[model samples]
Target: MAGAVQWIAESVQEILQISGLTVQTFLVLCSTFFLACVVFNRSRNLPPYPAGRVPVLGHLLALGRAPQLKLTAWRRQYGDVFTVRMGMKDVVVLNDYTAVKDALVDRSELFASRSPFYYLFDAIFGFGKDIFSASWGPEFRQRKKFATTVLKNLGMRVGRGSIEDNIREEANCLRNRIAENNGQPFDVAHDVAVAVANIICSMTFGKRYDYEDETFRELTKAIATISIELGAGHITAVFPLLRFVPVVNRPIIKALEASSKVKNVMREEISRHRENPRDFLDFCLLELEQQEKVAGLTEENVMYMAQDLFLGGTDTTANTLTWSLLYMTLNPDVQNKVHEELDAVVGKSLPTLSHRSQLPYVNACLMA
Candidate 1:
């Protein structure tokens, strides 16, 4: 009877040990299978992106540094239109100008929906209805038509004589500053930027500041800084997820804070002129009143319209003028032709709008 009891206990112990081992082995196998699926499943829906990435981040790791160069290289490697998956988002890059035109202009409606990354702009400026950054919809079209009309009314049909005079004065000041540098190695980028900024300032607020003025300098610096950062490859528009990554993306947050202050300053200017307005602010206020009658334009939309004027009128002209001087200085023949034309028409006096047509060569030089 003792031997029988001992044998039964031994059999029970062996069965329990075998069951525990089997359960452990099954769990290990299940875990391995799950991990494998996770690794392989990421590539399943992806549209043939470049190889190399951690489990879910698909090529996002590569974008941690010099993303533009990497994008360019990917274009070189995988042709112009390759897919890049970043945290479940599949971004298709249209590298060629033709593709971009086709998307932005041809099938504009389908692509008109601004990408998800534009949320940052909306969050920062509260500008979901602005013409430039707004999503494509009825509101966008309304704003677009209004912007076109206002801009045309301001400058297109008749010469903006007052605006031109303001620009001319600022441009003349810029030229004198450059001349004062006496061809020394100085950064003319800032001076050129300030001239352009003052042009917008005059257009918006009916005022222009001197080059030596501290407030004006701050405004221009802020503008230049914002513009360059916005265009940089690391911009949040390019990688929206970067906004959440604190250690790697603190600069982005700081920039947003700075930009918000700048926009506030702009809004303060608008508010100051609410009672008595002039120039473009006056036009915008009038538009807002009209929009109120129509019950179509929200305040947010109106503000974005103001933002568009400030951004569009400032940065583009600045770049054009800067590049014009840069190319003219680089090409002596072009520079001499410009000087000759100036000598013939303006003759060391400040160039006026009337002399513009007469000085075609100078105009051509500028165009170049």
Candidate 2:
């Protein structure tokens, strides 16, 4: 296609201009030669990987429309497993589920470590002390062991009941807010984010806030910004060179600053909880104390673990709630069935954790 040629020409032109090299001139020869050396060095170091048309850039160019789908198609053409060079690094794509299972699950020790793409690991993660961000080592194992023990002792059956209760309460709040809008156009993303944040707050801090509350709103915005930015193409985990470049650094800096503010708030909250700890915070504080005394855990590591609990526990549940609400709105019959189940189970009373299991259709609707 003409577009393909245009891209190649542009890429070549940009390389020359960026290097300040004259085309077909002796003065530019050294710079071009240096560029060639860089390219060759990268190629020599690159793993045995499948490549697209472009040199160095590789399949990054052919990734059109839905890149994952395109990659799948490429796998069909190439083989079940293949590699693509994205810039200076190599990406190995395993197409077959069996291959993934054998490599990742069966041979986990070799493949267990997460790639740099884990933003939570790279930034705002206590310089690699938190279990989520900790590199493979004995310390990581110890931290994970502590976390598993704590999670098990949290009385998760009771926690599940608490979570179910919170979900119903949040659903009511969402419905009431939507009703107030009179079906007018409004952004539901904020509501979903707030609901999820509050759930996280409840579990971690044992507190909840109104969606409209200024503090809660700002907190949600910060988390949303951090989440969106990290997942965007702005940050590169695998390639350290890309991270140092000015183009990549700017957004990452902004995201990190925002994330720092969020962390400061979390730190303050942790401080407050430490001073007068209660409920889950008390539990965390007690664990921190034990770790400090027994395991010599750093303060930074403790805070990072708490931070993980706050974000991880909330965001997924909130997104799921938003999706479920959207689906219900598009299917009125399904919504009515949910209402019918709610009425039958709760008998016009606000639904509670005890009523959850009785509302099978409601549960099914939520799952769908």
Candidate 2 residue lDDT tens string, 212-298: 899777776676667677667653554446656787677677778777877876777777776544445566677677664326576
C-alpha RMSD of each candidate structure in angstroms: 9.4, 9.8
| lDDT, candidates in the order shown | 0.70, 0.70
Residue pairs clashing, model 1: none
Give the TM-score of each candidate: 0.72, 0.76
Clashes of each: 0, 0
Give the per-residue lDDT digits (tens) of candidate 1, residues 98-150: 98998889998989876646444556445566677777887777777766665
lDDT of 2 at 102: 88
The most accurate candidate by TM-score is 2
In candidate 2, the residue pairs with backbone N, CA or C atoms under 3 Å apart (3 or more residues apart, or in different chains) clash, namely none
Off by over 4 Å in 1: 1-56, 60-82, 86-88, 95-102, 118-122, 125-127, 156-162, 176-187, 235-242, 292-296, 330-333, 352-364
Which regions of candidate 2 are displaced past 4 Å?
A: 1-48, 117-121, 158-189, 235-248, 275-277, 292-296, 350-358
